[model samples]
Target: MFPKSLFPIALLSIISLGSVSAVDYSETYVGCVPIGTGTSGALYSPSVYIIEDCNFACADAGYTYAYFSNPASSFCSCKNTGPAPGDISSVASGNTNCGSFQATVNALATDYSFQSCYNSPASDDTTSQSTFDSCFERCSTYTNALVAPAGTTYTCLCSNTTPSGTAESCGYDGTFFAYSHTAISSPSLVDRRRRRLERMKRDEQLRLNRFCPGGLQACIVPGSDDSFECIDTSSELESCGGCLYGSYTNSTAPAGVDCSILRGAAFGGATCANGRCEISACREGFQLVDGKCQ
Candidate 1:
């Protein structure tokens, strides 16, 4: 009864509406219909016919509880909950990647002290006063964002067990930390934390080697006479170039005082006049051989 062109237009409208409905159905993550409920014995009968197909605009705007009826109706709308859309996405303010996380982490400094107890057999004891001291020093400088500096304590209870088990933790250190050694035959929590810290130190050193190589001696030695090889200069030669026990040289030797002839290969063997240390060739009449004064 309708004109040919009108029929085609009507068909197109129906098709468009169907397509829209399909898209609307895919937008919602969940949907349900409640059939009946009573005070004493409430019952919910599932009914797809009463459910609704939501729209992207509704979901995007954070409309959770929704119910649809007639042309368009939403009975329950979802609550707006979840992390802000851009907070953790590529679209975030800084758009920082995982590598950027390291920069932020390195910029921070935290300090924590814990009492470590070693109760292993006197013969198989791996705990040493020197090792603990070194580890404490390392902890003072470990600035990792993944961990906090305060509120952490660890204790190791050791026994002569062949195979080790998972470490347990107990007792709080300060106001924030508590660790227990669970397994009698396993490495204690303190030991595990120590091992983890040691691994981080090694990894950091490896990275330093890749970036600065021979100069990393300063990073490792704490204080060196030569400042050029060190990354961070803390307390005089003790924290920057070399420790009080070490020495460094960047100065060229006088004509007859060839540093290479005295210090040898063990030394970087190059003439350096800048930085904290500067020593030419061998002292007095000693010849530079290998890495020592000959």
Candidate 2:
């Protein structure tokens, strides 16, 4: 699929959409728009990705209108300012949107907050630029809590528990951008093999919760209904030091602190030190003084 940012400006102009350059175009402006840093594009969604979804996302980003086109793939572009009066029919031309699948993207996803693009914190990691599934897996795997963009890169960011600062009006640069999280995806993609793996992992974690280890603090992973790869609490980012919510299956396995998910310790500068989480950095505009991002 063609990248969302590469969609021609002429197409945007015809639909009364703003260019990626932050310039307000007349409703009749049918010229090509210059490709720019991926800022002007407010948000992107998968294929029942409706015009209303784009409108809602743009409105959250302080824009008046949104463009949803699926000539090849789903693309949602946000435009700022007002559309100067002009020939409305000429620009309306052959513009159309297509998202036939159900709202599967929103069903399984955890609730997420949206704003405009922000200076992506130095992310702990990034997923492959394939689809939302990759981003979803990576984010849930690491924190299951907070996820941010990695600057202007095409992948979802793996950052701290929360992000701070204000969102930009139009082209926010790497600044934070808001999304509705009401994504639309094909049925097969949503119920793919990777999703099954996630379910398996969940069941395995639950088993460990039921029959936990006291001595080694081990977690069960396999068998017809069993598995391997115990949760290494010592260095594991998700389960650092010890399990945060441990209980005895038939014995004791008390819960411990989870360090990698320190609130406000964004920008990916967190580490497990001596069975405790050490705050090494914070997100932009925050001072990491006295072991805290203030």
Candidate 3:
């Protein structure tokens, strides 16, 4: 069960999940534009083979615009803004269109309000408005404003794209919001963040495994498929090898002792290794036999 106040927020998140859609290339102007030939900008790598690849690269790098030239060669370049109208060459059959990348909306709950609108390098402000509805109206004015977040009072912050470290919270005591211009409601920005979180989770799990290789006490079984457990196994006598002692039973005994000698030694000089008990030496006055002390 969840608190009634949280239901709306949960519902909004669920609704937002369904809104994600593919990128739209038509919003941009497509033409053959050579990099460094017409404008002064930094050249990227050959890894950007496709238009989407270039767009994502530019977005991740915090560039407002990206251009892919020589599709076959995958030459790409990023810039703070697209090339000038005069610099654009005739539209080529294979060249990608120059357009702003779509941004995802991120909501941040805050305890203070924004003193002023903080726009990114390529952001457009909708001025101060009284309501969220009025702020959304300004989104229509900026052709590239894909992400718009209503700020304190009537201010609206809009941007053409979002970067990896884009601020989630703007002002003190102010709630941040965002919207997309594309039909697909889900934004790539959110997707990127989600992927990053998943990677972090995987890395954390790997770290845990490295620290506790044999599995932590009773919480995990050393060699079992389902090894993870929540119960504390550190002091468990039965699971000395990180699993139930009975699980290691052999023809010689119903239960095997762990590596420690604290458990009474029923068998002569018995030692546990890899979940199995072996007799390397016998008790005093005992003579060694075929497999045990006689």
Candidate 4:
């Protein structure tokens, strides 16, 4: 990308397709106009132009190319392929020509609603070159967002919430360019994960509603058949805390439970602590192992 200012006299010689003839061009003149400054009241830079000539034959290619001899910078050349001249008449007058490339430059500056390069803001002029250098260096390594050219700043774009929980924002800043939030992953995967989590949560809710209704919370401890750790608010009985093995048997127990102690007690008492029951010596004897209280 060459500076648009080099269009007028800088020559463009295009090699026509399948032809030995060369189309040579040269800008003979250059000029500029003043554009306004920033809200901070800085002086804006002036526009530039080039005046030139075509020494060789022109082509029907409908493209105008210009190259600035200055190789010190990146944007030192310009080229454009526009509609071909309607007739030789326009070609002779340079009507479909690039003598006015300053027009594009002007448009670019105005497109962003900024001052021209020459009519820079007073604040911009007052800033030390070191500050600009630092800003420019910082802008180059940035990729989390778009980086503007050396002089501009970053701006934010508008955002709308998608059906998904993420938000998107984008905009152009003089220094940094635009920032947008996009899905780094495939939408299907994100959607799938969301659905899976929701389903698990729903199932857990349903289980709670059916069995633990109106009681202090309970959980279905993983890895069992309908196995759950529930609390009996009414009695604090080992039966409520312990896994229900069908009316009296100890089946599922919360972690650290001693279901064997629950025996035949009308109320699960001293035996149950923290969801587990402790077996007493008398209850142990009642087991009648070996056909005796032994």
Identify the candidate with maximal lDDT: 2
Q: Compared with the true structure, what per-residue lDDT tens digits does model 2 show for residues 164-199?
A: 554333222333322323333455644564554455
For model 4, residues 182-289, the per-residue Cα lDDT tens digits are: 322355744564464355335334533343445443443444434444555233443545333331112222323334444443232234445544444333325533
Evaluated at residue 117, the lDDT of candidate 1 is 18
Pairwise lDDT winner, candidates 1 and 4: 4
The full ranking of all candidates by lDDT, starting with the best, is 2, 3, 4, 1
Model 3: lDDT of residue 224: 55
Q: What digit string (tens of lDDT, one per residue) describes model 3 on residues 152-184?
A: 343455555542234433221232333444322
List TM-score per model, in order. Answer: 0.19, 0.24, 0.25, 0.19
Residue 234 in candidate 1, Cα distance off native in Å: 26
Candidate 3's TM-score reads 0.25
Once fitted onto the true fold, the runs of candidate 2 whose alpha carbons sit more than 4 angstroms away are 1-50, 53-113, 126-128, 142-153, 170-172, 176-294
The prediction achieving the highest TM-score against the true structure is 3
Lowest summed lDDT window (length 10), candidate 1: 101-110
